[model samples]
Target chain A: MSQFVMPSLGADMEDGTLVEQLVAPGDPVQRGDVIAAVETQKGAIEIEAFEDGFLDRWLVPLGAKVPVGTPLAMIRTGDPPATPDIPQPKDPAVPPPPPETPQPAEPDLPPAVPEDPPLAPEPPAPPPEKMGTSHRQRVTPAARRRAAQTGFDLSALGGDRVISLDDVPSAPTADAPKPLSAMRQAIAAAMARSKREIPHYYLSDTIDLTAAEAFIASRNADLPPDARLLIAVLFIRATARAAQSFPEFNGYFEEEHFSPSAAAHVGMAINLRGGGLVAPALLDANEGNLETLMMRLRDLVMRVRKGRFKARELAEPTITVTSLGDRGVAGITGVIFPPQVAIVGIGTPGWQPMVIDGQLVARRVANITLAADHRVSDGHRGARFLRSIIDHLQQPEAL
Target chain B: MNDKDIRALMIRQLGQIAPDVPFDTVDPDADLRDEFDIDSMDFLTLITALGKELGLSMPETDYDQMRSFVGLQRYLSSHVT
Candidate 1:
């Protein structure tokens, strides 16, 4: 028999929650078959089978929290072990069984004394003003310390009703700690490593969106309710096309070598309302048509907002894009997600005067910044990639 | 049932779930969630995998009690008997 253990999804993760079990005991599983779902710091991932065999035993139950490498279940390849008779151990050197006790004889005159015992009745105890007065209330240690530090009376705050300190705001202590949610911790580790390890080089370009906006307006007039394209969809499509032009930017860097990939898996940095971020991918952005890209982008954003994005959605991005359109930020530079060579940051569209064939005219322009790994991509290549995206935006009909 | 066998099985199982994870350096005491970012679904899959490998009956409710390596070891030890 072989045990299947919990897998560490990333470099920084230590533990994971077992969110769901896809397979049960006695099920035949093969290699790469998804057996269960795990919630990592990154996101929920499907745990795949390692060996082909019958699922013999489950070491841990579903929804159990487990450390890295903890045996989650087992598979039996050989013949099943025969059932062994586990002996119930007897107490060693046991004393002889206790002698049977003899019963006492009742007196024959007991009938004469039974009539005098019912003369007095006992008094009942009085009920207290409040119930559960002696019950201990649950409160954290921090709350206890806060109540001690401040003159605030916890008893008075909750009244004489078996007061609980939960409602009382705990004073922050030096050791006041809360477990980091699986997502937040993962984000912290990834961001910290990206800042520390990856050498980021940023390049910014202002693209005239005059044609793109007009093209969008024209398309929207005839588009279906769900097929209407947003500026983000246009940015993604144009970036995907630009990635094709600059193949070097659409790949990963590993072992000091740049591996250019054919697929343009575009990841979008989505800002969650409470201030965390998740970058779910629009896989194969170049393969889909305009309507498909629009629907996919919309779906990805909705999933991201609801925190229901799957692990595959966040992994294997060849390139990433982040936009601050709703924030009204004109332009901002960003760091690249490591392994992936480049990330494009999109800014809010603004009206700016531009020289159109030597004559000054008001035009809507969007600022796009590309941050690339300097070890893999040089300044010239990065600039050209940014320029190509701008060119695509300028001629929107071509995208 | 031996310790070495169990460790080897663990390494093999971990590799299957995370193909890129370096098994040789994995610390047993590390919280898989905090240290490696293993999520709930992955943990469940791991349990299912282990159940198939070890021939032990583990129910869903048992997962709630088995949060750490020691917890898992105790759970297996009890049930394997």
Candidate 2:
């Protein structure tokens, strides 16, 4: 039996609580099938099974917080030599709607206490509190989980030793519309780390999209509505193609070394309905056509909102693109997510007067900006990379 | 489809794109993008959904014309058979 340990969702995640188990003992599972939902600081992440086999059993009980790399379940591969069979859970009949009695902290204290405090015992060990009192700031696991979900710093509650349910504040007293959710906290931490470590240089240029728009219009005229392409798809395709041309911006920078990736996985930044944002990769972006890319983007957006994402999507984005086109922003400069060398930002397209063939004509134009790690590339290289995107966009038939 | 039926269908199609939009508060002539939080994606979804429901094909050239409630109704009435 092969052990399925908790897969780290992102660099920011330390530990996560197994919220729900989707598979039962003896159930067959494929490699990519989602087997469990883990609640981390990032939110409810659906954990996919990495190995194909019969799910032997859950190793960790639900609601128990465990650090990263902890074994979550056992997948019976039955491939190698005689393996020891793990006994099935005692009550295997009941599945995971209600977590089978959270393993209570097995205390060292003596059991079998009288209904009333035994006579002659000096104030009889004060009715052993259900919540642990040994720790100076004792907060119940359930309470801590709730606080994390609500983004309230429990440490804010001054030196109170034993914390009860009532001690946790429900909301933050600030002007913000809503208190930062766990996802927002995670995003902030990641961005802060990105900005602190990566020395970034930004370049912006307004690209005329008149020819590209016309090309898209003609191309989309014959297709069905669902199959029709969006300008954003063109944006991604062009960027992917440009990255293929200018290889400097399309890879990870690690250990004071720049590794250029052969395959371009463009991370598309999707804003969540509830506050934060996640930029999951559009795998093999350079190879796909506009139609396939659009469909994949649609599916990715849908799955992301539903909290269903594969592990690779989160971890494998070599470069990211953040489009503020929907919101009427003019231009944006992104802070490169650490390890990833560059980030591309696209602004809203608007009609602007341009001189075409010595005549002023209204053309659809958008500001495309590139933020690259200065350690890997200079402004000249960044400008050339941006020019490549413009060149591809200008010739949309190639995209 | 009749004008009233088409309008009703259009509202339903729009609801699929953005369910939280208060239909009663929606101004037919105002740009939905500005009034509500309907982005380009939602706008495209709305157009696609309408096309699917009505068995019509909406070209990318006509997106701006069909962006608002009034614009969509006018465009559908004129372009659709």
lDDT of 2 by residue, A1-399 (tens): 889998866655567778889998777888989998887654577788887888877887788677779888889874432443545547654344444543222222222234432223122232355486544556777666545544556667744576667777744222213334556566766788788888999899999988888887887889987887778888888878888887889988878799998888888888766457888889888776778889998888778766767666776788888888656778888888767889999998888999989999999999889999998899998999999998999988888
Model 1 chain B is weakest, by summed lDDT over 10 consecutive residues, at: B33-42
Which lDDT tens digits does candidate 1 get at residues A372-392?
Answer: 888888989999999988888
User: How many backbone clashes can be found in candidate 1?
Assistant: 53
- lDDT assessment of candidate 2: 0.76
Residue-level lDDT for A321 in candidate 1: 91
Question: Candidate 1, after superposition: displacement of residue A244 in Å?
Answer: 3.0
For model 2, the stretches where C-alpha displacement exceeds 4 angstroms are A40-43, A78-179, A254-258, A356-361, B1-4, B77-81
Scored against the true structure, residue A366 in model 1 reaches a CA lDDT of: 81
Query: What's the lDDT for residue A36 in model 2?
Result: 89
Stretches of candidate 1 off by over 4 Å are A1-15, A25-35, A42-60, A65-182, B1-81
Specify the highest-TM-score model's number: 2
